[model samples]
Target: MRVVSLVPSLTEAIAVSAPGALAGVTDWCTHPAGLAGVVRIGGTKNPDTAAIAALRPDLVIANEEENRQPDLDALRAAGLQVLVTEIRTLDQAFAELDRVLAGCGVRSRPDWLDAAEAAWADVTPDGPPVTAVVPVWRRPWMVLGRDTFAGDLLARLGVRNLYAGHAERYPRIPLDELNAARPDLVVLPDEPYRFTRDDGPEAFPGAPAALVDGRHLTWYGPSLAEAPRSLARALRAARR
Candidate 1:
């Protein structure tokens, strides 16, 4: 089954589980590196519908959060079948991954998916919950808020998002306000924005900074298998 994947995580999952199923992929689908012959269809928010349609894929994969509605509409209008996924938590991620893979004609569950489930199953909070501010972007400073997959992952790892109750899923809070929140830790991921020890930590003098891998913290695919352990190590190091 030929498919075009607009979601990065799904692209990696499909590439690893059902090889040669991807006819096209977005420019940002960077995991499982060396995607040699796959056609590049532009970014997730602004995929080239004409290019995607020309590929004649049996199915197109996307995420409600990462992809634009107008793009999905255009694809459907052109007689393409689009499978949009919404993942707000780890459970949803696993379920949606299964659905997307099945849509790609994968009859059996991939071993990576089973391993990811087992990995998360073994995770328990190492200690008392530590409140944190997880900034996804800088400039205007957008943070993970409300019911976000990243926030839920952090919560499971014993890190509570300071803005988890906010009305917006990703809220742009003023830098001053974020500092004023005085969270115990400042959790920074490398993508959506590249937050390094030098770039992100200086802003929050009051809280210790935990610089974690963006893929492990955000992407929900094969990386999920190692996220709990990788994130736990980063958090533990930050506290020390």
Candidate 2:
């Protein structure tokens, strides 16, 4: 089955479960580098509908985090069968993988998933919970504190996620409230915000800051294997 995967994670998902079936992938979909030479279909938020239509794929894979609805609607209008996925938490990640397998008509599941789950089970945070601000943007700024998959992942690291209490995915907040949160660590993801710690004191005033790889903290699939180890190293180095 010829398929086009628009989401980044599903590039790996389709590669692992439905190899050779992936006819195209979004530009950001880079896990299975074998697809590096595949057709470049722009990014998740902005897709090239004309280019995609020419591919004549039997299926299309998209993600809620990546694609805007208007673009997806355009695809649907073009008679493309798009499968949009939403994996906001750890369990959802596993479930979404199975969903892809089912959609591909693949009968057997991968053994690596079980191993990934087993590895997750072994993560033991090394420190007392530290409050953190996870800003996704710079101008107005947004963070992941509550009700987010990232927050859940941070919880596994034994840190109290402040945004876990926020109402929106990336809420726009003032500088004062962020200061009032009294976070021990103000974190900036490598993407979305691209935070640098050298300017931490100047940026947030009182909070200790660290720039971290957002992929490990956010990407729940193959990239997750490195998260715990990296977090362990961060904790070991965290000043008391």
lDDT of 2 by residue, 83-146 (tens): 8888788878878878876786667877766766777789887767777777877677667745
TM-score of candidate 2 relative to the true fold: 0.89
Off by over 4 Å in 1: none
User: Lowest lDDT 10-mer window, candidate 2?
Assistant: 231-240
Task: Give candidate 1's whole-model lDDT.
Answer: 0.93
- Return the lDDT, model 2, position 120: 79
Q: List where candidate 2 sits over 4 angstroms from the true fold.
A: 34-37
Q: Quick one: how many clashes does candidate 1 have? A: 0
Best by lDDT: 1
Across residues 109-130, which tens digit of lDDT does each residue of candidate 1 receive?
A: 9999999999999999988989
